[model samples]
Target: MTETTENKDLVQEENVVTEETVEEQAELTVEEQYEAQIAELQAKLDDEENRHLRLRADFDNLRRRQQLDREAAEKYRAQSLLTDLLPVLDNFERALQVETTSEETASIVKGIEMVYRSLIEATEREGLQVIQAEGQPFDPNVHQAVMQEQDSEKEAGTVVRELQKGYLLKDRVLRPSMVSVNE
Candidate 1:
C-alpha cells in the first residue's frame, strides 16, 4: 500500500466516526447517545445487584426453614416411644384399683415391683428422676402438700410421707411430688 495523505485521513476518519454516522447507527443525537449508554449500564448494574440480593435472601430463607424442620423432628421423635408406654401405665392403674387373687397376689405384687423399678430406671435414662420429699423440709417448688398432720416424731413442716412420687424430666418438672407434711 502507498503511504498517501488521503489514505491516512481515511483511516483516521474510520477510527473517529462523524457525529452524523453515530446518530444514524444508534438513531440518537450525540447527547442522547451518551445518556442512553449511561442509562443502559446503570440498568444492567441494578439488575445484577438485585439478582445477588435475591439469591442471598433465598439462601437465608432455606437455612431458617431447615432449622425449624429439625426442631419439629426432635419434638415428635419420642412420640411413638411414649405411646407404647401408655399401656404399662394403664396396667399399673388397674393393679392399684383392685386386689388380685390370693394364689397369685404375691407373684403379681413382685412383678409389679419389678416392672415399676425397670420403668423408673428407663425413665431415668431418658432424663426422668424422682424428687426427694420424705423427711425433708417442705418446699412448694418441688413438693405438693396433700395433707397436714400433727406429729411428735418429725419436726413441724417436715414431710412425713409421699403420696405420689413426683418426677423431673431433664431440667423441668414433669410432676410435683404429693406429700403429707407434719405440722
Candidate 2:
C-alpha cells in the first residue's frame, strides 16, 4: 500500500475507537444523571417528612395548651361571684360572735345564728372553705401576716390569732387569712 493510503487507514481505525469510547462515556453519564436525580428526590422527600413531623408536633402542643387553658377557666369560673359574697359572710360571722345580754336578745341571736349557719352551709356546699390560720403554722400562701407578736409559748412563725377570716374555693385560695404571727 502507498504511505498516504496506509496513514489514512490508521487514522480511520483511531476514529472508530474514539467513537466507541465516546458512546460508552455517554452511557455512563446518562446512568450517573439518573442516580443523581434519584438522590436529590430522596433528599427532598426526607426533608418534607421532617417538616411534616415538626408541624404535627407544633399542632399537638398548641392543642394541649388550649386544653389546659380551658380547664383553668372552668376551674376558676366562680371566683368573682364567690369573692363578692365574702363580705356578707364575714358580717354573718361577726353577728354570731356577739354576746347576748338578755333572754330577748338571746332569742334574736339564736335566730341570727340559724341564718348564719344556713349561709355557711350553703357556701360550704358551693366549695367555700375557711382557711385555718389560728394555732397553725403561718404560711404566706394561705395567710397574710398583718402583725407580728412576741410570744414565749408559741414558736416563731406560728399563727397567734386570725383578725379576719380567709377562705378557699376548692384548691385555690380566694383570700389569704389576715393573721398575727409569733415572732
Candidate 3:
C-alpha cells in the first residue's frame, strides 16, 4: 500500500509538469505570431511612406515646368502679330525707294516717310530691332547668304552687301538678313 501511494503521487507530479510545458509552448507560439504581424505591418507602412514621397516630388516638378511654360508664353506674346506685320513693313520700305520727279510726288513721298517713321517707332517700342549685316562678319544666325561673291576690297567670310533687312524681337531672330558674302 505504501508503494501504490508513491506511484500515484509521482504520476500526478508528471502530469502537472507536462501541462505547464504545453501551456508555455502555446504562449510562446502566440507571441511569435504577434511579432510576425507587427513586422508585416511595419513593412507596409514604410512602403506607403516611400510612395507618398515620390508622388510629392513628381507633383513639384510638374508645377515648376508649367510655371516656366507660362513665363515663356508671356515673354513671346506679341511674336505672332509682329511676324504678320513684317510683309507690310517691307512694302512700306519698297514704296519709300521710289524716286520723286515733281513737287507733288515729293510731298507724297515725305508723307510716306513720316508714316514709315511712326510705324518704325511703334515697332521699336514693341522690341523690334533691325539686324546690321553689311560690312560685318557673315553670321548664319542673323544673316543668310543669298549669293557669294569674290571681292578684293573685303576680307573673306565678310558680308559684302545686305539685300534684304532682318529684324529681331528682343533676343529672338524674326528673320535673317539676306546678304552677299565675300569669299
Who wins the lDDT comparison? 3
lDDT of 1 by residue, 67-121 (tens): 9999766755554564466457557756755666785786877788788778757
Error of 3 at 90 (Å): 1.0
Clashes of each: 0, 0, 0
Q: Candidate 1: where are CA atoms >4 Å away?
A: 1-103
- Model 3, 84-145: lDDT tens digits are 98888999999999999999999999999999999899888888999999999999999999
- Give the number of colliding residue pairs in candidate 1: 0
Cα RMSD of all models vs. native, in order, equals 9.3, 2.4, 2.3
Sliding window of 10 residues with minimal summed lDDT for model 2:
118-127
Model 3, residue 154: what's the lDDT?
A: 91
Which candidate, 2 or 3, has the higher TM-score? 3
Tens-digit lDDT track of model 2 for 134-177: 99999999999999999999999999999999999999999999
